[model samples]
Target: MSKLDSLLAIPVLDRSNQPRIQAAVDGKAKPPRALGRIEELAVQLAVIQKKSLPSVRQPQLLVFAGDHGLTRSGVAAFPSGVTVSMVDTLLAGRASANAFARVVGARVSVIDAGVAADLSDRRGLIHAKIAMGTQDASKAPAMSTDQVISGLLAGADIATQAIGDGADLICLGEMGIGNSSSAALVIHRLAPAPLEICVGPGAGHSPEGLAHKHMVLAKAAARTDAAEPLEVLTQFGGYEIAMMAGALLASAKAGVAVVVDGVICSAAALIALRLAPQALDYCIFAHASVEPGHRVIMEALEAKPLLDLDMRVGEGTGTLLAIPLLQAACALLSDVADLKDVLEAAS
Candidate 1:
């Protein structure tokens, strides 16, 4: 097996970790009541007849923006300027995510995890910059451990506060040039797969550029110890990815459902799962991305993505689009009429 495979071979927890799951589920559990089999069937019948469950009271979208040093190595098709521009677009309510958030009634919040350009601390922006930019990973470590830890802590704190602000559902998105490379590194470290299986043409890279990206990432991995996954993230992952991972952890801890977008967000989810396997119970895979490696990661997580719009955008667009489906799932469980209700209507 390859070194990447061996790293992923490390066994984490399995289904036996019900205590953690119970902590999340029982956090809001009520006392059990006695019921006859007929009554049990009646409750199930009622659920089928209703076809909709209790509405999710509050949903929040957390967008993390950063800059990747690997962009300096020409790994990404888009320049770092796009990160700042997109942040402005998001703030102006003109981005695709903004439009989708409006459709779902989700509150949006943006965080400057490490954008290279300066953003004014205005309304709707969370000032959580860890560094102006990560170090050039093509040459050395992308970020120091202190910066990564700080970013993670900031993200966790923000998520906890959002939960306290009455957010029951959390959607994760990211903005960072060359972030796909950082995601690939994290995926490589956490997944039982080859680097090539986890690398893809991010932001429309040409074949040659994609090859260069894979080579640089492989060399970087060779220089690092895969045994320490968080160390790999600190050294090679994007600040936004690190922060998003922490947000996933916090959401799990807070008993909120987390919706994960495409590949980059999936990478963050993988890292979070690595840290706390129970976190997976709270995550819903949003969509299948066009990126080549995304499927492999999804398979490793055993996640069935809700949609396959061929989207590769990292600004939480996929997650935003998938919100309605979640609503529909709840609706099906609570609102749809069952056979008994139909027979009664016929009578």
Candidate 2:
């Protein structure tokens, strides 16, 4: 069987430790449920790991970079070349994601899922390009079924490698210029929301530019009638997003925590969750994006993110910011003493 097929065989996370995790969290020295979302996060990590005390010591943040064909239609405020430059910045460890990784003590890696430029010479970047770039969805299907499968398989392999190298937690991020438009379309179809609701100003767009983007996205959406998750992804075409989806599947299968970043990453999560409804058990929605469509997708997934930072910078920046909370959760569960134990000591 193909790698993608093997990843799909992942069973739903076993919840046998549900009571033990909840009991452990409640036994913390704090009052009942006083820790709020952190407690919930701790329980989630525990359940995913099948242990009452979980650890987030080793985190791998994979920033999948690609180019969108929709950019050629003036959907983005920046040029598509910016995607290439950003990939180079990531490789040089000069991007904001790199800085954030340093601060959070997480390892950062960039993958050339499908950039329009030739980045083969980049020293540290992972080479897994599915193509130069996807076709313009406004004119044709963004990718073929085979391309979508290949991208997903490539992503799964990258994620598996990270896990094998000691990544207990994986965060998803993406850098693709026109991908916001692609993400919007993916949300529109997969979330079953209105096209207008899914379109937003990505990477900063003027009012007129945003309007033109809506028009272009509408044209692309009308080009295909694919409502299924994978079909929608294939119709919209985004190598980075597809790879992110693959990574999500692989991480969940390996019983690791997956920190989902902003709208684009969440769009990829939607595809993965649709394929394997159980993968949601391993997902941790890092933060709520300022992008309007994000709420729609979140609501569709019935996921409540850990933070509402009103941030829209994708490149896994939000994920990096949220990693500390996961660490704190782990500490709260593992390091803190039980309330009864503290009381006995006091007596």
Candidate 3:
């Protein structure tokens, strides 16, 4: 069997709490605002005032990088060192995300959430480490509840500050090895889907490696207590994921648009929706990733992803790609000559 097939073969345990399930299922809960043709026309009208008017402020990209203890168990196809290496590549402007962000005219900020390696002297990186790394989910809890809350708060604070610094739109992304396992655990808790549907071949794992990952995740899920969102996050979630969730909430509260990337970011978005369903008003699903479970999460949230380029690289590449589309949307709404205006001129 392929890696995805083997992972899907494992039975999913019911680890969701009643309150969360009820809240997620409750239709009376504030229904998400679906932007249809009329809403799209309205958004266009609001922004397209005049060509001479200043365009909306430049978008900002926030990339959160951390290390997952699950990597130590060979659950991932890439080594743990890749996490630090990718951060360096990002700093050096050599990563694919950097190139993509530059093309979209978005400024990228890299936050060191909790990479195991020291990045103390990195000049441009944001130092927001909550711990050396998250705890191994296979043997014990991923992090303390307090730690998870702190990480989330810190991430939100960063996004708030970025907006204050003149950012109008926000794109959420992450970098971490073995994070897919953490994402799977979070999705399982938040959505109550089959384990196979929640899990995917992160970074290209072989069949045996993927099966091993599924078994470890199944064991972790079995041991977790699903009483509350925070408790479940502490039990089996990654620090970066929790922080991204917090950032999403903060962006909504701040009234800024948030573009969500692939599966990992979608996990965070799911948590954000659970914590504050109103936050959905400020979100835009950027893309559908090659990861099998990403589409499932997107559907659950009723999110219509903007792009589907088979992108599985995390670091906000998909979100960055969507920035130009958003710019075009705003431009078309505000700049195009209306039929009335054209008729008046002709007359």
Off by over 4 Å in 3: 1-55, 345-347
Q: Rank the candidates by lDDT, best first.
A: 2, 3, 1
lDDT per residue (tens digit) for residues 256-287 in model 1: 67889899999988887876776676777888
Clashing pairs in 2: none
Candidate 2: residue 119 Cα off by (Å): 0.8
RMSD of each: 8.4, 1.0, 11.0
The numbered model that scores best in lDDT is: 2
* TM-score for each of the candidates: 0.83, 0.98, 0.85
The best-first sequence of candidates by TM-score reads 2, 3, 1
Best by TM-score: 2
Clash totals for all candidate models: 8, 0, 3
Residue-wise C-alpha lDDT for candidate 2, range 1-347, written one tens digit per residue: 86667888888788888888899889889989999999999988888988877898899999999999998999999999999999989988999999999999999999999999998889998999999999999999899999999999899999999999999999999999999899999999998899999988989999999999999999998888999987999999599999999999999999898999999999999999988888998999999999988898899999998889889999999899999999999999879999999999999
Error of 2 at 211 (Å): 0.7
Clashing pairs in 3: 8-196, 44-333, 48-334
The candidate, 1 or 3, that scores higher on lDDT is 3
TM-score pick, better of 1 and 3 = 3
User: lDDT (CA) for every model shown?
Assistant: 0.76, 0.92, 0.77
lDDT by residue (1-347, candidate 3, tens digit) is: 83212211322222233333222222121233232432342242232221222244578989999999888777889988899999999999888889998888899999999998899999899999999898888888889877987877888888889988988788998999999988888888787577788899988988898999898888887886573667777887887898888788776666567889999999888887776665675678888998877977887788788788999999999999887777765554445554455567889
Candidate 1 TM-score over all chains jointly: 0.83
Supply candidate 3's per-residue lDDT for 190. Answer: 80
